[model samples]
Target: MHEGATLGRRFTTLRAEPHDVPGVDRWVALDARRDVEVTVDILTSLAPGAVRQAAVRAAQVRDARFARVLASGRENVGSDRVTYVVTERPHGVRASDLIHERVVPPRVAGAIVGEAARALQVAAGQGIHHGFLRARAITVADGGRVVVSGLDAEGELATQAGLGRGRTEQADAAALAHLYLALVTGMESEQVTVPDLPDALSLGAANLARAAIAGTGPDTLAQVAAAMGPPDPAALRGLRGSLPSLPAVAHEEPQEPHAPIAVSPETLAAAEHQTELSIAAAVAAPGVAAEVAAERIVAPELEPGAAVDRSLYASPEEAAQFSRRTRKAVERERDQPLALDTFEEINEEQNAGDDRSVVQATLEFAQRHLPRNAPLDAAVERAQDRAGRSGPLSTGPLLVGLFATALLIVGLVAFNMLVSPVPMDGLSTREPDYPAYTFSPAPLPSASPSATNTE
Candidate 1:
């Protein structure tokens, strides 16, 4: 096993110098260069974003498409769970009447990274754009816990195990399970598409999360806690519990190497079945997980011809605003799927280069090179079918019944509203086609005959 491979895999490299308070600026390496990098300074900022609850709701679906996309791909499983690192600092005040201190709900300036990840489409063996994450994993050089101080230190304090090995990997199974359940909706058991989850997840963090939330229900904190643990080499082995154990320390090992992404047609098609299902599910329920699943977000109500890639905008705020114009108000259209084939094409240009490729780069290639003129409605329908089968598993039959009832009601209403009294007049038209013609006799010859006397 190599050194720091586990922990380092989740992040790109960061070059840092100590700020007076130890922060980062003028990064030489960053997670992505192709897509706009948003610097979120946590000072009680609020931007438009997806709600965490909706994301959790999507995660709950028991489907296969979701599984294939999440599991088949190399996930950011090594990193800590997605965090909403909130800190309160004084920005300019919105001074309302001081006397009535309104207890306003907390303004969420912090964006949920997991949601951001959905647009990134990080997965196993996908090529990257020339991208790097300028990340610094600081630990005490003297065998003590290193304070992860850079930029927003308070934000650092709020996030994932903060550089300690926590058991987050076990939830990969559960996450993968949800991934698949979101895919194969309406199949029989063989085709039912269940993501294989290890029967016994030894990861301590998951166990703790489960213990914490078991009574209340499946909360995000419990779920995040669940993911804390080891990496499995056989992450793609379809059978349940087939994942082989890798050393926990190996996660941080930079030396240990694995197979690189192969750039070939057959290689691209290797996970086709799995990927197809996952994509179908993603387009259907493109929740916050879209980043991890590597789906481009489709803005709401975009015309079929418009670009729907989530990667286009720098932040969710930009996306939200673009969706709000009278000419433009619509949810983001996840554009990466439209570009998947492009990833298959020029991937060799990006293959096997850690320094050059960012996940966004690979997706950008998809956006740039993949055929954009797809039959948009058809793809959506296909994804919708899969998503419905995978998700809202119970609501379908009810909706069908409701539709039938609605039709009946509509028919009855039309019969009543269309009623009118009969008119007494038989017909309101008269014939005007025939015209009379008169014939004149030869009366002019009689006048001339009078001159000829009594002949």
Candidate 2:
């Protein structure tokens, strides 16, 4: 792990675009009601010798006093270092100011002015900062602990590190946070412990990503990573395969079988006996009988293809004596049925019929003609009702009977009310022991309504 890599990227939200003119500028803007604004001065510096842009990121962390050193003949330096002017003043130079100040010579040609414009745009939009030039160790976290068991110094493990640094591990600060998130969520206590580095990356993060770009093929770096843990780095390989243990393996030689197979004599005898019994039963028992019985059950349902027309037996003694006389008469005609042809003609006529209602009605009547034992009882009940209706006691008499019933019910209720609940305390009451009275016919008064109506 690189010492600086332990640090992660950090930032303040961008506020406003930076402008070319620089001396002191408002770094960030805010809505007074919603957001509180803070002002801080920014200064930028390159690594020893570097170029300066048109606008420094307002939020760049530096000396707070601007400083930079730009190589003059940088084109001549391809991976080669060169000497150039160094200055601490940001407002000291502007491309526009530089353009008018003195540039009569083409040898001191400038980088495209558009590049400077882009720099200004970045300052305004993205809020450029010192960290963008070189990854700075801005991110901070407590380095919890370091536990190393396998690998050692000299870039070695329990085995050894490659002759050179095997690989450069690339990871973002978000990736570090994501890893801890997974570990915490999945309850993963195990972690990788790598060599101490800067940026506050703990052993957990230090060894999290370690691979080699220096090597030609994966053999060296891959072997180191392979030795470190499982062979593949899912995030690196651009795949997601399980880091689970390899399928189980049996390295030992398989045992050879003995010449004579060993078995219990009784077990063998039992198996042989069962097999013999099954075979004997199959050979002797009637398997075909069940099949024959099923065939017999199906026999009554089909007509024989070679059967003579049934009319041939008509008027024969058997036909005269046949139990169903109607069918006998049907069979007697010389114009007897040619069944298959007759059925086809009948079907065609039925299909062509225009009177669909009559067809439906005939089918309904045919269905109803079938006798039902359940309905016999219902028929008897209907007959009883008809008999009752036909009798001399007609609807008028029924009304009279109903009126009489109502009067009887009212009389019973009135008599019950007049009787006392506490009569003789329910036990002391004794009826007068006397002969029951027979009423003599007393004539209703001649002036009553019945008598007057008769008159």
Candidate 3:
């Protein structure tokens, strides 16, 4: 299939090649429509009912550590039936990859298992078990965040469909322990040796791993989470074992040189005395005429222990001279005025000019690339002008007008309430009928009178 081809009518395949999932025919195809990277597992051979049930169960799961199922459905592709389940793509290397690369620290392993256990707990709460909770199913995201994926609806569906064995909470716990062991020893074997765990890890961490794998320790995931605390940074330093040894180099024939002559005892003793003096001088006053200090501290020949003074220098004058020199140096440093050199001033000016140039360039670039419109420009200008001349927008008159309008409404409502008639006992009484007025004939009159006169 080509990239951008629609999958299930909503997700577009981002790449042509699909990632193969181990022990399953379903290949992971990256989706383009998702905000975060997500993969859709396209299974060519899965029962429709299994797909539907898995989709429902996957949707019901809502845990941060669990890779959420975005969508799942069955679709007809050409002459074949295909089932697809889309899940959020976790953003890190696989736990198994990390395990093979280097030994995972015990504390880090504990923490990862702990996180996975929490996720398992969530799945168990929803009556869903992760049948395939292995190292490859777990991902260590950035910032050491552990994400558990591969909880495809098909696996659960398969189990329910009687094609495979069903997974339980206890089984998930055991798998988590195995995962921890694999990480600690950098091996994927069921037979775990707690003694092989790095010396850097705590005893509690080792025990936790053993308990998890053996089903002897914390039976519940919550208890496991509580037991596996955060890994110690200091302990993590010694997590990895020694590096592999290099190949041995072949030896060549040895060459003989002239024998060295022995040095006189007097010269050796004097050299040793000088070394001791130098060390003492460095310890007493570092960088303060170290060589001269060492020389001055040299022991003078004593005439039968003749009254040794408890002073570093042989005479008081020497001590006074040393103090005077130190004071002079301090005075010189204090008297010097603090000022920037010509080179420093020049550099500062150059830097300021460069900053201005950069700002101008950025502004020009933005103007060239950014879209513009006359109405938007006008609106922005108006907003800027308003902002420049700002006092708070006066709402006093508006508030007063609103208050008056509210009062009028209240008054009208009150008047209507007071004057309106209310029906009593859910019946309306009709008004009594009034007599109607009848018009009397004015007289057949004038015409009849004229007729009578004529007769």
Worst-scoring 10-residue span by lDDT in model 3: 239-248
Candidate 3 C-alpha error for residue 413, in Å: 82
Compute each candidate's TM-score over C-alphas.
Answer: 0.16, 0.12, 0.46
Q: What order do candidates take by lDDT, descending?
A: 3, 2, 1
Which structure is stronger by TM-score: 2 or 3? 3
What value of lDDT does candidate 3 attain over all alpha carbons?
0.61
Q: Looking at model 1, how many pairs of residues clash?
A: 77
Candidate 2 global lDDT: 0.29
lDDT (0 to 1) per candidate: 0.29, 0.29, 0.61
Give the distance in Å from residue 89's predicted Cα in candidate 2 to where it truly belongs.
26
Off by over 4 Å in 3: 1-4, 16-32, 45-48, 152-154, 157-165, 212-218, 230-455
Clashes per model (N, Cα, C within 3 A): 77, 12, 0
Tens-digit per-residue lDDT, 111-189, candidate 3: 7788778777888887887775677778766556677876646456555445433566766766676677777777554
Cα RMSD for candidate 3? 32.1
Off by over 4 Å in 1: 1-138, 141-145, 148-412, 415-419, 422-455
**Backbone clash total, candidate 2:** 12
